[model samples]
Target: MALNIKIHKADNRGKADYGWLKARYSFSFANYFDPLRERFGVLRVLNDDIIDGGGGFDTHPHNNMEIITIPLKGALEHRDSMGNSSVIREGEIQYMSAGIGVQHSERNFSDSEPINLLQLWIFPKTKNTKPLYDQINLEGKRIQNSIQTIVSPEGGKDIIKINQDAWLSLLNSDAGLKHKYELHKPDNGLFVFVIEGETVIGANIARHRDSVEIKGVEEITLTINAPSKLLLIEVPED
Candidate 1:
């Protein structure tokens, strides 16, 4: 498969610590700029944010974009001007379509526990569709030895839908078994990111926080070496 790719090791990413919040940008942001690390495809930002107890970003404005928040650990109390307010904990996926305009804020509700979350921005297919907010809890998803669908268009099955055709999937290991993770979208490209543990993708090896983009490959196969967690994004190659 001929695919453009980038690998962000856990230690080599751009890190910024601001007392109450610590963040690592997989791609450059604000004053940080790396010509080779701007973004991947329509994926603009992949921010791993760790917010201290009762700390988070205040009201923020965004437009013409799709913002997705995936909490890896702890919980995030979210409030938007669209009349949506909720606590998104681990196993929950949240999406906000800042189509025309949207104002929102995120904060950790716990007084002593920190929150680890992933904030991702994706370019939407349609412009100015209207501001929206939605969240899905995937506590009932099951994928014995493969990846589970967490986000997709139209909120298909057990996935949280976004405004784009892109899809996000997660894989959690069951045991010491070789697993096959397949991307059904052959015309689209697959961005595979390992969240934890080690897994073999095709002939390449990927460890925690590492990723590989595979295009033109009809399917992908993963050999889970241990109890692993993975995230896969399928988006149009164009």
Candidate 2:
């Protein structure tokens, strides 16, 4: 089948700054509304956020949403009503199944260093399930110069489980590197997020913070133009 691709440039994303925090929304979020960019398949929210030292989001509530947090730099202090509290830093991914409802708070753990992270919200396959929290440390487990699964459905090896059939993988490679990503489900679509550096997806170039939504193809090829970090999400299109 032929592939269909749509690119979302970094600068085109919605931006918000509040002194202590700076955020770029890939989809409609908070006050950054865009009718055309509301969502991509089951992927609801993707926010690139930077929090200054000692600054962070206050307690908030979420329900029926699969929340994933990827720390790019520094550390994030998390505390929830489930009596779970911990600090998640770079090289780590956190998952929170806010089934039914949950109240949580995330703050910068460092008093001097800023924290950069990606927050993703995926619609769950089922509603009113039990809330849960988990984190995965990717220190030595992640595959170098290739894509590695960070989040997947239960029964996957060494992966954080989510309440959906989606799969989330991380790719880190140097310039001139080439890789291929195969879809787990034929009806699913892939959302490629350029976390750092640049890459060529099909005929288009995606720079830092840019994203490419792809569908129809069974696999997609990526060419790294520079040392790059990417997040590939495969989720149900319908």
Best by lDDT: 2
TM-score of each: 0.91, 0.97
- What residue runs in model 2 are displaced by over 4 Å at the alpha carbon? none
Cα lDDT of model 2 by residue, 32-65, tens digit: 9999999999999999999999999899999999
Candidate 1's residue-wise lDDT over 1-238, tens digit each? 4644445566777888999989887778866688887767677778888999979889999999899898999999999989998999998899898999999999997989999988888888899989988888887665656667877877866577788778888878854667655555667787777778887776677898877767776676777877788888888766
lDDT scores for all predictions? Answer: 0.81, 0.94
Residue 63's C-alpha lDDT in candidate 1? 95
User: Clashing pairs in model 2?
Assistant: none
